[model samples]
Target: MTLDTKKNVFVKLGKFLGQFKEENCIKNEAVFGNDLFFEKFIDLIQLSQSHNGWYTPEQVYFSIQSWADALTEENLSQWLSHYDFSKVKPKKVALILAGNIPLVGFHDFLSVLITGHDVLVKTSSNDQHLLPFLANYLIALESGFENKITFVEGKLEGFDAVIATGSNNTARYFEYYFKDKPSIIRKNRNSIAVLNGNESKEELAVLGEDIFRYFGLGCRNVSKLFVPKGYSFDSFFEAIFEYQDVIHYEKYANNYDYNKAVFLMSNFKLLDNGFLTIKEDSSYGSPITSVFYEYYENLDDLQKRLEDENDQIQCIVSNNLVKNSIKFGTTQKPNLWDYADNIDTISFLSII
Candidate 1:
């Protein structure tokens, strides 16, 4: 199929997704194929938690809305305009998806297919349902997609290249196994925020969205903070208090209780706010219901350190204190063009 054909299909898929927001899922009769897929999609969203406890309705709906906002004709055109597809030859790109958050791997899936390659997906067991359902919807919009998408349950093979996302441990296995193939093997990375003690309460409140969205499972979620020396946590804690309801979730509460106990037993001092805890540590990756913080003496030194250790970091959150830092509260809502790990997937695909 032509690029416009493929793009149009996704635009339709986006419109279908646009109907199912967290506030209300109103059916739009103008959307194609909704008669058969609309109600079923709603049921799937509601039941997603059964498959993965972290896939709460609120989280799933937020993901849906984000995608709905992204898959527009204008956004797709702007993102694709940077590439030359006329000379491209279709290849099979195998994707090993990570299911930590709802639809976490959708961007890679979209990238492969939108670039005119066939996709062989190995969906993470934690996220088995949502993508396939959307694939079916895409196929319904244009029968041509049926030939381009495949779900692999066994060992992945017969792909010209691969894209895999996993923890630091699994990434080693991927590198050794797919060493011969053209691949993008992603490893564990965490996001951090740099605080200057001058942020307004409103910015800090939205920063809570960055911390609590997806319960801090996404790589883009801020898991650590860099604050100035002698900076007080009073205002920061007060601003984020709005998200305390997250503690009501049993899974998060259990994590809070367990990690808090472990920290106390280890003789580590913690700053607790009844729901979330902030500990002084150097690690970028923090557990759920908690965030690690470190004090920095100078922005210049911290910038150099972050630059030198870029691989371990996913994205930075700040009031532009660091170069290319993402604004507070928008980390989880990445643009279609924002390549993960700062590696351009389209450029990689174009060469392959």
Candidate 2:
């Protein structure tokens, strides 16, 4: 396709996705029943309790809005700070997804669709409703969309490039299998925060959203925190206490109890709010095991620690760190320019 074609694709997609409301996406994601949109997304996150690849409508809304916002200059700029966009282009692509997080594969799907390439996607069973459901919604947005996209459940042959996401272990498998193909193999990554004691009740409230939204189950979710030595966990805990409503009955209760029991059985030291466990560790990504937090002596040490662990860092959710940086509610939501591996997604699409 030509540049005009690519531009037209963007025009159609923007118009379609721009007007998209939660209700529409709710219908798309639901199997049946009253619009359980936010509830379903919440269930997904609650189910994140078991690493079952779920999400609730509220979280999905946060994610989709983040997705919508990501296409433009605002969110994309922070991403572009580290990537080069001049080389992006559309290429025949195959995307294999990870079932760990809700719509973990959608970023690759959107990149392929918006970049003006034919996309063959294999959905993760944990989130089977996502890409196909999103495609159904995006395709219905306009005529060209219906024509531009295809849904492949298993696998596809003939591809110039590949984009796949999985556990670090699965990433190794992806590398060995796709070694000959130009690809971006996204593996496991953990996000964090370096609170400098300036956090107010309002900011901590939003941080509460970041941690609990998906039950601390996203790559962008700060499974850990980096506070100065002797940092007060009380400041953060007080904010989390306000969200006491999220812990009602059945599944979430079962998850809270099960994980809590495991922690008790193992004698793992933890700071508990009767809902979340703030344990300290150096691991990335929460496995429904427990949320880990760490402390740093100063900003320089924090920067060095993150830099040294760049391979394991996905995103940093903090305020007052940089001008246009991400806040708590915005984690997991990525912009178009925020390409995986800091590579320009659109430019890559335009090139090979």
Candidate 3:
């Protein structure tokens, strides 16, 4: 199919997704194929948590809404406008997706197909249902898509290139396994926020969204904090107190209890606020229900350190205190053009 044909199909998929909200799922007759797929989609959303405890309805709905907002005609045009697709000789692009958060690998899936290439998707065991469901929807929107998308159950072969996302360990294996083929192998990375003690209570409160959204499973979730020396966390703790309801979730509560016990047994000093714990750690990746924090004496020195270790970080959230940092609370609401790990997928695909 042509690029415009592919784009129009996804735009329709976006419109269908827009009907489902956290509060309600309102059906619009104008959305194509809703009569067959709409009710089934709702059922799938409801059943998501049963399949994977992390895939709660609220989290799934948030992911759906985010993609709905992203796949608009305008957003797709802006993201794809920078690439010249004439030179893209259609090839089979294999995707090995990660399932830490709902629909975590959709961007790669969309990227491959929209560029006029066939896709071989091996869905993460934790997220096998949602994408296939949407793939079926896409096929319904355009019968031609049926020929372009395939879900592999065994060994992945017949693909020219691969894009794999996994932990640091898996990345090593991916590098060796796909050594001969062109590939993008993603490793574990974490997001961090820098605090200057000048942020408003409102901004701090919003930062809680960055911390708690998707239960901190996403690479975009702020898992660490950089605060100046002698920084008082009273306001920060108070602002984030609104998210205490997270502790009511059994899985999260179990993690909070377990991690807290481990820390206590190790005699690690911690700042506890009933639900979340803040520990003075030099590391970026934090466990669930907790965030690691480090004290910085100089913004310039800290920026330099972060730049030197850029591969370990996904995003830097701040009040523009550091160069190229994103604003508070917007880490999870990334635009279509915001490529993960600063790697341009389009450029990579264009070459391969």
Candidate 4:
């Protein structure tokens, strides 16, 4: 199929997704195939929690809405305008998806397909249902996609190249195994925020969204903070108080209780607010329900450190405290052009 045809298929998928709720889903048949697929998708979204405890309706809907916003004609055109795909040959790209959050691997899936390649997807067991179901919708929209997409249950085979997302340990295996193939192998990375003790209350509140959204599971979630020395977190704590309801979720509450006890027993001093904890630590990967914080004395030194440690960091959230920092609360709402790990996926697909 042509690139325009591929874009049209996804735009329809986006419109179908637009019917799903960030708050309440409303059926709209104007979206392609929604007359038959819309209500069923709603059922799947509702049942997603049963499949994975973390895939709550709200989270699933949020993921859906984000994609709905992104897959617009304008967005797709702008994102693709810079890439040259004329030399692309039809090749199969095998995908190993991550399921930490809903549709975490959708971008890679989209990339392979949009670049006019077949996709062999190995859906993470934790997120098996959603993407495949959407694939079915894509097939329904474009019968040609039926041959273009495959979900593999066994060892991936017959793919010209591969894109895989996993933790550091698995990354080593991927590198060794796919070392001969053109590949993009991703490793675990976390997002962090740099606060200058001069942020407005509203900005701090928005930062709370960055921390707690998706229960701090996605790579874009701010798991660590860099605060100026002697900065008082009183206002920050007060601003994030709105997300206190996250404590009611049993999974999160259990984590909060357990991690709190472990920290206290370890004699690590913690700043607590009943639901969230902040501790002084140097690591970027903080545990769920708690965000590690470090005090930075010099902006120049911090910038250099972040530059040096870029591989471990997925995003930086700030009010321009650091170069190319993501705006507060916007980490989860990445544009279609915002390549993960700063790797240009389209360029990789074009070459591979």
Say which prediction, candidate 1 or candidate 3, comes out ahead on lDDT: 3
Give per-residue CA lDDT, model 2, range 316-336, as digits (tens): 877756322477766655555
Distance from true location, Cα of 62 in model 2, Å: 3.3
Q: In candidate 1, how many clashes are counted?
A: 0
RMSD of 1: 0.6
For every model shown, what is its TM-score relative to the native structure?
0.99, 0.78, 0.99, 0.99
Model 1 earns a TM-score of 0.99
Give the C-alpha lDDT of model 1: 0.94
Sequence-dependent TM-score of model 3: 0.99
Model 4 compared with the native: what TM-score? Answer: 0.99
The alpha-carbon lDDT assigned to residue 182 of candidate 3 equals: 92
Q: What range of 10 consecutive residues in model 1 has the weakest lDDT sum?
A: 1-10
Model 1: per-residue lDDT, tens digit, 69-142? 99999999999999998877999999999999999999999999988999999999999999999999998999
What's the distance in Å from true for residue 87, model 1? 1.9
Candidate 1: give the clashing pairs: none
Judged by lDDT relative to the true structure, which candidate is superior, 2 or 3?
Answer: 3
**True-vs-predicted CA distance for residue 222, candidate 2, Å:** 1.0
Shift of residue 132 alpha carbon in model 3, Å: 0.2
Stretches of candidate 4 exceeding 4 Å from the true structure = none
Instruction: State the lDDT of candidate 3 residue by residue for 277-315, as single tens digits.
Output: 989999999998999999999999999999999999999
